[model samples]
Target chain A: MTGKLAWTKIALPLGVAALLLLAWDAAVRVSGSDIFPRPHEVLRGIIQLIEQGLLLKYVVASLFRVTWGFTLAVLIGVPFGLFLGWYGWAFQAFNPMIQMLRPISPIAWIPVAILWFKVTDKAPIFLIFLASVFPIAVSAIAAVQNMQPVYLRAARNFGLTQLQLFRRVILPATLPQIITGIRIALGVAWLVVVAAEMIAVNSGLGYLIIDARNAGKRYDLVVAGMVMIGLIGLVLDLLVRQLEKFDEVRWGYANR
Target chain B: MQANPTVQVRDLWMSFPGKRSGEQVHVLERINFEVRQGEFVCIVGPSGCGKSTLLNIIGGFLRGSRGDVMVEGQPVAGPDPRRIFVFQENGVFPWLTVTENIGFGLLKKSEPERAKIVAHYIEMVGLNGFERAYPRELSGGMKQRVEIARALAANPDIIYMDEPFGALDFITRLKMRADLVRIWQSEKKTILFVTHDIEEAVQLSDRVLVMSKRPATIQTIVSIDLPRPRDLDSAGYLETRDRIFSAMGMSLRIGENEKEALPISAQQPV
Candidate 1:
């Protein structure tokens, strides 16, 4: 029964997708639509795109854009969040600007990214960083703010000085939330990297898709790049979640 | 000669500003008490009668509105490392192991000394096997024992416990009270305990203080005067319990009608 149940879970989603693809295939053949290609045709094009090395080139470029931008976001975001969370004046002052800039879309910043960094890879990197930074940072800040007052009081009652309190209590408590934020931001960075690359960078998965489309061939490369992005993102997210479990077991802070 | 007193409160007045008015509402009014060195004094009153508030004031965690509290003749300004406080709430930090929690206050000591103190307290508390275990792994009673061990390990001049067993089940609370008396006798340190449990106050205290309501003040101080190893069911113990209960506005007159009840000794402290 367990084996049969496991098979059903996989079969359900697969069956739905297969049905959708069959419908899409039938529609294209019957209607002669140029926009929606048959699943088999897209799969076949993927093989050809790989043969031309076009698929590999775009994926690597997009990966590079995401990697650099995500790293910069974490580097800046974590400490900025910590500061805004820990200190009253910093939170009060920075909160307004944070909320304002946070919701602004990465694509919307394309013109300024081009103007400010001006056609260099930095422009796309900046755009990806813009998209990723706030989710992680804001989550970290919220984590710190949500800490129980008793935890601080208990530390103080033990006669810990402020620095010790920060190192021993605040930092440890904020870590899980910060990690959650980083995972979320990393996902956002990957999502925006394609858009950023299509506009700014000369190469990447996003570049590969757009470049393939511009070449008037190979919808397969675009589909291949999209699949790779989703698969790679799932792997990265899984890695962080596993790390969170390890921390939860070791630290025993949040009881999760 | 009587043992020297460690704490002396002279006309201690503690009040807080009222919510909507300019009035200074009193918690303990003109409170004066002295804890003899090595004496165990438990303050018992109704729940809102500010016994815990007075304990906080003694620990130097709160300021008196007027008058003074002196320990070893020095006035208390804030929480003194010399006086350790064990609160009723789970006092042990959940993240720390039993050994780590016990060693917390002893951080200022030499490493060898801290290790020695931690080992000693762990043994005394019968938690030797669980030294490396986290507080979350321990039961509520076990956690309270760890708190007591930690407080004892600090070797403070006085230990203030605010209903340390208040959260425990009945059997556990009884066991803890007995354990506390044993520790107090062995260690010979001053203890000022706060509880609303009349039985606990009567059983453990060298003196039981009962406080009246808001703008609260000590309504009476009744010395147990019974021989230690105190017998809670003994004649003197029953008498003392009745006296304190009476001070708390409960009449044991119906129960007191029983023939040949223990005679309560109320010595007017000069």
Candidate 2:
């Protein structure tokens, strides 16, 4: 019974995907659009990229930028957010500025990024950081603000020092929410990295799409790049979600 | 048995700022009580009667608007490790295993000492074989046990519980009360418990302090002189419970002469 259930779980999504691919192939054939590639043509395009050794290089380049940018946001945004959350005065003073910056899209910063970094990988990396940092920081702040007051009271009753309270009580209590924030920030980072790559950088999946269209109108390769981005984004999300499985933070999540 | 008092409150008063500016809403008014060393005292009152406010003041989590609160002849400047407060809500660290939570206050102790103490309390609280379980894995009663164990493991001179078992089911609450009495007998720690349940107040306390309604004051302090594991059906138990009920201006019989409720002053223990 267990085996059959697991089989169905895998089979259901695959069945839907297969149907979608068939529909796409039929649409391409009936339309007879020379530029629009069929599903098999996109598959061949992916194989072609792999055979040319460009697939691994491009995928690695995109992932590297996302990693650096997302990691930087986590390192800086989390502590800053925690500080603001802990100190009401700090939040009051800085919240306006954060609120102002948070609404401006990372794509809106592309011109500024180019002017500062000048066609380097840093330009896209900077954009990714800008996109992801606010979500992470805001989530952390909300986590701390919404924490159970009873925990703080209990911690104080135990005579924990301020530093110890932050490290032991505040940090652990807010972790589940902070992790959720990080997951959202990662998604934003992935999105901004692609947009940044399209304009500012000469490598990665985003560049692959633009270069295919500009250089040869290889719609098949463009679709292949798009597919790769979607797949990689899914994998990154799945990896970060695994953090919620830890015993300490598991209480924050609902039981399935 | 009249040893030195562990906690003494002198004409304590507490009030919060009203919704409108420059107005005050009094909670506790001229509240005075003394808890002897190793005594189990329960403060019972109406739902909003400031029993919890009194407990919080004694616990040093909140300062009274007026009056002095002394613990072991020293003023309660703030929450000290020597005294712990158990909240009505589940306060066990969700991230921590049972062992870690119980050992939370033992950060200054050596690893071996902490482990030994945690293990001892786990056994005492009847949480054996569940050392690795987190708060989420435990039942309500078991979680309360973890909290009580945590408070005890801290080795405090006093434990102030604000309706610690108020959220538990009927059977679990009864079992917890018996277990708590057994633990109190063995440990002999001073406890200042606040609850609205008259039966619970009577069942657990050496003395039950009945408080009046908002801007609350101690209406009466009823001494429960019954033995441990006291019979609930006994005349003495029922009399004491009814006295507290009457002291709160409540009629013992349902839909009876509500007008015949005794005045608060008449119910005071001589």
Candidate 3:
């Protein structure tokens, strides 16, 4: 029964996607446009990318940048969030700055990133890091502040030391929200990476799309590139969603 | 001097700053009490009468402005592991399963020791098949059981509970009271429980400390003097329950026996 359910979960979405692709192919054929690529043309364009080995290189380049930027955000943001959450004065002092920076889109920083890093890898990486850190840090702060006071009382009553309380109670109590924040940050980082690749650097799915359309009017390659990005993003989101199944953190995600 | 009580509070006063400027709202005033070793004592009062605030002071979670709370002959300064709190099913860690929560305080112990203690409490609470379940998977009564088990597994000498069964339904509350009595008989821990339920106090406690309305002080300490497996419908039970109600300024002699000379509203409080 479980196996069948799992099979259906995958098969149903794939079936719908195939139907959508067929409809797109039919629509393009009926329009009789020489410029518009059919589903088969898009497939051939992806095959061309594979034969040239650009697919692996571009996909890996994009993924590698996202991974490092997100990892750095987690490292810096979590501790900063814990500090801000735990201390009243720190939160009060730093909260205004966080709020101010949070609203500015990472895409808007492209020019500064290019100027500062001078068209190197650092430019796009910096943009991705900036896109992710605020959400990660702010959510962690809210998680700590929103914690039920009873948990702290119980932890204290059980004779946990200050450090132990942070490790045992505060971390676990705020973990579900922290995980949620990280997921949101990862999404923003992924989004910023594409835009960053469009101008700040080259050789990612985003650049593949723009370069295909501009250099040779290869709209087929552009559509293929978009499909790859969507598929990869879906897989990344699914992986993060799996974390919500943990027993300790499952309660927070029950309603969701 | 006199056999050192498990807990003792003298002239306890607690006041919080009111919403307005330069105004204070007194929660507990001139509160005084003592719980002997192995005693199961309940502080009963109307809602919002500072009974919980008094418990917090005695449990070392809060400080009384002008009084002393001594525990084991030492001035109560902060929360001690020896005095664990079982907060109305709210203290059980949600992220942890039953086994994990019960073993939480025993993190410093050996793995085998922690496992054994956790297993014992899980069985003691009658959660035989739910050893791996999380707090959200359990009922209100079951959640309270988990909280109690966690407290007991820590091997605390004293357990303070604040309205532990207030959120539970009538049937579950009755069952929990009985379960608590059974555990207390076997374990013999000093328990200081606060509640607004007169019957609950009379049924579960050896002595019920009834408190008056806001700026609350202990009005009477009525000894239950009832046998184990208490019958809630028994005449003695009704008498003791009525006694606590009377001390809280709600008498039973109003409509049936005597004329309603004093309106119940005049006697009882919000």
- What is every candidate's C-alpha DockQ against the true complex, given to 2 decimals? 0.24, 0.84, 0.73
Per model, how much of the real contact set is kept? Answer: 0.14, 0.97, 0.95
True contacts kept of 1: 0.14
List clashing residue pairs in candidate 2: none
lDDT of 1 by residue, B61-179 (tens): 78888888988888987777667888888667665789888987776799998999899988888887999897767889999999889888888878889898988999988888888
**CA lDDT of each candidate?**
0.82, 0.93, 0.89
Show the lowest summed lDDT stretch of 10 residues, model 2 chain A: A247-256
Could you give the DockQ of candidate 3?
Answer: 0.73
- Model 1: lDDT of residue B243: 77
Best by DockQ: 2
TM-score of chain B of 3: 0.92
Which runs in model 2 stand beyond 4 Å of their true positions? A1-4, B260-270
**What lDDT tens digits, residue by residue, belong to model 1 across residues A46-161?**
78767888777766777777889999999999889988998889999999999999889989999889889977889989998999899978987897898766466556666778
**Model 2 C-alpha lDDT per residue in residues A1-256, reported as the tens digit of each score:** 9999999999999999999999999999899999999998999999999999999999999999999998999999999999999899999999999999999999999999999999999999999999999999999999999999999999998888889999999999999999999999999999988888999999998999899999999999999999999999999999999998988889999883
lDDT of 2 by residue, B50-166 (tens): 988889888888999999999999999999989988889979999999999999999999999999999999999999999999888899999999999999999988999999999
Local lDDT at B217 for model 3: 85
Clashes of each: 4, 0, 0
Query: What docking class should model 2 receive?
Result: high
Q: How would you encode candidate 3's per-residue C-alpha lDDT over B1-270 as one tens digit per residue? A: 334588888888889989999999998888888889999999988889988888888788888888888888899988888989878647888988999999989989999999999999989999999988988999989999999999999999999999999999999998899999999999989999999988888889999898988989889889988998898789999888876666666657645533324676677666
Candidate 1 docking category? acceptable
